[model samples]
Target: MENPTFSIQDIPPTLLCYAVAELDFSTLSPNLTNSTLQSLKSCGANQLAGLLSSFTTITSETLVSLGSLAVGLSPSVLENINGSILKENLQSLSTINNWSATQASIIVSKCKVQSDKQINADTLKQLGSLVIGVQSAEIKTLKSDDILSLANNSILTGYMEKAPIVLKKQFVQGIIQATSKTKKTIFQVVPAELASEIPVSNLLDSNLNVSEINQMKWTSSQVLPITNQAQCKSYFTRVGQANIDLLPQGSPKRNTLLSNAKSCLNINSNIITKDNLVILGSLVCDLTDKEIISSDSYVLDALKICSSFTDSQKVAIVTKLKAQYGAPSKWTLSNMKQIGSLSSALDSEIMKTINKSVMIKFFPGLLSVLRVQHKTTFTSVITQLKNSSRIAARDSLTCEEKLTTDSITKQMDLIVARYSAAQLNICTSNETLLNNLNILGSLAFDDDQLKVFKGILDMRLPGGVPNEYLIQLGNIARVYSEKEIRSWNITSVDTLATLIQSASWQSNDSKINEMVYRYLQLNSPNATFDGTLLTVLAPYICSLNQTLIQNITSGALRNSSQSLEVSTCNQNIKNILFDKMKLGYSSVNSTSNAYFQIMSPVIGGARFSDLINFGKGFPEMDLSTFTTLNPNEVKTLSVENIKDLLGSNVLDINTISSSSVLQVWVASKTQMEVNSLGVNATAGIKSPVPNGVTSGVGVPHCTLYLLLVCIMASLLYMDNDFL
Candidate 1:
């Protein structure tokens, strides 16, 4: 029941062939002895064919070798051969010299051929004997060589001549290598449905007549992948301008042909004229920016000569030019002139490509030209110039040239006062102050600007301080108190000196005096008296009290002898006190009650010795130097001074109420008592009379309490006339 096994090498060729043909091939080993394979030639062709048919998995090479051997057997073997084996060995079909036309027809009908592989020429010649044997579709599937071979064979030509349109297109594509005469014949036979589908490159190989080239209408889908520059040149030459123009837009062939056209033709050639280029304009548009820019000079010249462009086409050209050159700095003068010549619209658009510096430098001249040439749009041009100029100015300021005096002034001139404090702060600088002097005079500064201005002033300039700059600093000082100024590092001494030197202190006395006070306060820790400075500051010393004066002079003179130039210092001191006393008394009528109230405590503390010392410095006056002995001065207490003392105490009501001085005054008031005994001038006396006491007795004593109250009240009112 089991199949018998034999060593494949031991089997005889005739016996193996017989067994292979009779048994299920699935049961047989594919391995065969070389002797057995060589002896296959002795087997009958019918048996060999049957053996090939029995094996489903035989290699095509094995089938082919066996089929070749089968040729030595019966011719009838070819007729009964498996179609798969026949198709695999179709190339071998031509080698079968004894094959009949009927056998050829049978093989062609039975086999399923590969579509991609070219059929042998000998096979086509053999198949041509009976064209009806081949499927119409199969005929079209033939490669170029097979189709050309069939084209030459008169027998098969009849069937191919009237093939269906799809088959006709394939047939036309296949015979690309056919002889000119044969290709011409084939072209002449091409059906109308295939007219557009045929590659124009194919027709050129056949020396297609000019009329034929013109007549061929390429569809939009036509693809000609040829890269032969000469062939492309020749095709375009034969087709002429009109027919070449008819090529599909953006088609590969159109690009290939035009690129070749430029290289082939000279600029002066008739084919390269403006009219021809105008016809080929669409092809120019299809070229990439790189391609057009890199194209041959003749091509570019041809484009230049062609002037029949629409506005949109010019725009497209300019757009491409922009892409090619990128920024305007990449363009040369010649490039600018050439691009400018394209159209006024493009010339105007090119302005966008220029660097801001270039525009600002050259715009005025260009604007003049534009005003004449593009008069209607001059205003818009001006507006654009202004906008670009503003950016250029800002960027220039941000560069190394930013803080130059001229640059700062130039930028300031353009500002419309609309910028925020931070934006305006960009312009605050020592250079700005030194150059513009009054830039910050009216400008409102926020906290940050104030800080920046302070820094700007703190920097030492070329000169000590500009004469006119003091006015500007006065505005700043008015806003910044001494504390704020110190925080910003703007030394109050320098500011005060600058203000004094410029005479700005005359109009801004209160601010200047405050600066002096602040400067004095700042130096208090290490203060020393400077006799020379004190002499110059004498008249202006009215604002400061003796205590502050003493502190400042003490510090200024700390290193110097206290007796240095006593004579001159004495005169200066005398003048200072006179000025103080004179101004204080003269200004009291107009001075605020609050001013007097503020000074009231200082006046109340003065003593007779102090009055003598002050009065000695102002001996020219009629003022009296009074102490506890001057009952006359006590009688001179004015209602105004007493009221101001009360008001001054009222402002600090809590401290005054709890003060020891008020306790003493109140205690003295409660202790005072008075007793009186009186007799009429008629000399009547009481019933009980004292010995030395007459009819009437009255008591009034110079008590310490009374004297104390009187002295305290007068002290509160000071030598009230002596401010």
Candidate 2:
């Protein structure tokens, strides 16, 4: 039978099935011909099953070669196939439309085993029609994250559409259990199609915590199932304003919920107290205009609890306030503060009537909420008040007392500082007044304000923005566009360093890259960049292209004083930088703890062989660098090393478990070690640590260690003070 070279097509038709089954299937040179496979389909099931069992391993090619004869394979043979091989060929195997329930079940079991008992959306999608064969018990075992993935995936939803009701019920229940573990509610997790299948009793269950029901949209049809009026009122009331605000405005769902809650509370706007308004929350907008106007002014103030108010509500409140306060000219500062957001609805004439001091005090709050048209009028009114006030105060000065130049200058500085960014009349203000305006650094000027400020700065410093002015500008320096900053004459290293630090906070990547390029272009020599310059600009050095980065001299990197900030740099950039650092810092032994410590930031770029060479020094590497290592490389680390590396990150176990790639490395550990990693043991690992026993080591004591260190440091400081 060894090396049987005879073609199966040469076999007589009557003997073909017997010849195919009897042949040494493993020793057969080329695969069976398609005509041979077609003839084999007429063979008995036991004969075909025997032929399939001859191979030590089943591959996708073997299955494809079998064609329709694959259906004749015994369940036991399919069950024994390697899960990894099965997962690899699931799409091709799934193309077989006539699989029996038993065959499909075996495939699903193998798939689950391959995925470590957690099937994600892609696997579910590949299963396709075969998903119907999944058992309710198996569906219940799916991870919450996996369930959430399936719920979010539209492709999986199509698969679930044809699945059995029992499986769907189990899937929905899994969603409920999953959502309970996190801040998300059932409404947030379940899709529209599956939502209708959720039982009414489940919706009423108190396990769905009220506080967790913060934000999610629900259609009227979806919510209409919960017909318990009393329960709805209590749940909605406790859920607070956050949930109500998230509801789609003007949707039937919002209208239905409002109508139902209003009826249940027996809300009467005419007799409504401030307490009623507080309890009603966002439902206050549902009240009629006449009802709002009829409500007491004190009761109306409770509307502030709601973040947004309807236009009709604002109008009604304004009318009521005007009636209570009489004329706008007679309205006091107390009246304005009492109205709160109602001031946004006030006319320009009404704003002009307010005292200058009162107006300035109210402008900050009003500025944020004002309509576009009202902002212009308010800005104009404030400007006029500022000019008239300065004139009135100067004119009132006694004739005998002459104003000094210093006094006049000081007076102007005081007046400019008193106004807000919106009220600042930059066009009329002199250079001295603009320089004295220290208030510009504190306020976040809008695009228009920044444009005006830039114009003023340009006129004052016509040569270009100097380093001193950049320091003076503080956060406002960020307002300069990337184009303008790139065009600057930057020569000083200190200015470049300061600009890099400032740009890191608010500037986008493109802008930071431009700033670094501009500074380098101006300062660095045409032939060779300085080592000290590289060290100062280390954070942004990675922004350069690969060729440019490779061109940097090894001597420059070796002589650099500070560590390169590679956290924001991609793997390619880190690889180039790490290579340069390796060559330049040749004096440092690669296997020493010093090497790992110094190279920890860019160690992720190191090759697997290089990491293995680090040996004991590997433990000293940063945890973030460890997370990026290949799973196989991670597997080579000792259990004690893993415990040491992950001990401090026990709190991040959930985040780690969320990633399939990280989970593979985590699953490589012993059950006891995984439990010690501080997550639920039943999910994949072993028995949990006893309540009194600390899980892993480091993380729990990190704070106390810091505290002890601080105390010792303090004692050392005290001894030095005595010396």
TM-score of each: 0.19, 0.37
Listed per candidate, the RMSD to the true structure in angstroms reads: 56.1, 34.1
Residue lDDT tens for model 1, 395-427 = 333333334456434443223212233444564
Pairs of residues at least 3 apart in sequence or in different chains that clash in candidate 2: none
Candidate lDDT values, in order: 0.42, 0.58
Tell me which residue pairs clash in candidate 1.
527-555, 528-555, 528-556, 528-557, 529-555, 529-556, 529-557
- In terms of lDDT, the poorest run of 10 residues in model 1 is 672-681
Where does the lowest 10-residue lDDT sum fall in candidate 2?
A: 395-404
